[model samples]
Target: MNGRLRELSREESLRRLASVGVGRIVFTHQALPAIRPVHHLVEDDGEVVIRSHDRTALLSALDTVVAYEADSVSGDDRIGWSVIVTGVARRADGADRYRHLADPWADGEPGYVIRIRPELVAGFGLPEDNGHAP
Candidate 1:
């Protein structure tokens, strides 16, 4: 397995992130780092949007900094890419307009729509080598 690691450009990273609808949002809870599996949509402007329940911990995290990560990897081939976006989270203004964008896997209504404006975007990938004897 001979392959080189590469840094994905901002565009490529965003593209890869956008290709997937599920990711993890990391934040602080009770003074400790917490992670939540969430479904997200990458807006045309490069912002990320997700829906949360009114009573969830994420509700209190509004206006705070958080990190969102999305990745894909082939376990057998050991090749994949990961992207992370660090940004501030806030409640979106037009909830009605973007309500359809929130598609959670769980049942029940998501009472809040949150958006993350990326302050930093980074990604990396390992391009796999073709099957051949070296």
Candidate 2:
């Protein structure tokens, strides 16, 4: 058998992100770590759009670059791949323009849209590192 191992390329990274419509967005608040799972839409320019309610904690804490992780897993033996995106996040000011493009899974949230412009995208497959049988 060939012992070739394949690494995820840039194209593969974006494609996988598009395939998985959901991801957990991670940020910090007052020296505390926070993570929220959000449904997102991928743009042609490789930005991720996430809608949040008016009471969103994430929206209030975006001054610097934040790391966001989006991933999917499949296999009975628990072997899977995870894709991570690190970027700067900002709240969108143009409501009308974002409203036209943004959509929430459920209606009537009266939410604001957060934009994540990724600076780096990386992915890796799970090995038997964390107590999984090879």
Candidate 3:
């Protein structure tokens, strides 16, 4: 409760993003704000990768600008961090090779790997106001 909200740098934001496994991909489904919860991973080159079924509605997002977000929070202390990545979504190469990175909650098999190049990365954190600089 005593923590302060602070902005996270791009490198720190990407690091925080790589720490989490789940997030939401925001795109247009029917012209309104459409979002889908997804499992994601940060690649060695810093691209954000996400898996989806071949029939997924997320295909509508391909070649378009989209937003992906992930966050971690503590319920009791109300301290947490969130990262949002904005970039163009595109079909990735070697989809079969990255299959093991995600643990999907749905029943269908994932046939696509979507990669988002982090064009604009932004994040914020609510950390306990410790005396030392974060």
Models ranked on lDDT: 3, 1, 2
Best by lDDT: 3
TM-score of each: 0.82, 0.74, 0.84
Instruction: Report how far off residue 13 is in candidate 1 (Å).
Output: 0.7
Specify the highest-TM-score model's number: 3
Give the C-alpha lDDT of model 2: 0.66
lDDT of each: 0.77, 0.66, 0.79
How many clashes (backbone atoms < 3 Å, residues ≥3 apart in a chain or on different chains) does model 1 have? 0
Which segments of model 1 are wrong by more than 4 Å?
Answer: 1-3, 75-79, 102-105, 129-134
10 residues in a row with least lDDT, candidate 3: 125-134
Could you give candidate 1's per-residue lDDT for residues 1-134 as a string of tens digits?
A: 23477777888888888988788888888888988877888989999988766346787678899999988856565547788999999888765665666556545554677899989999887765221111
Each model's number of backbone clashes?
Answer: 0, 0, 0
Model 3 local distance difference test score: 0.79
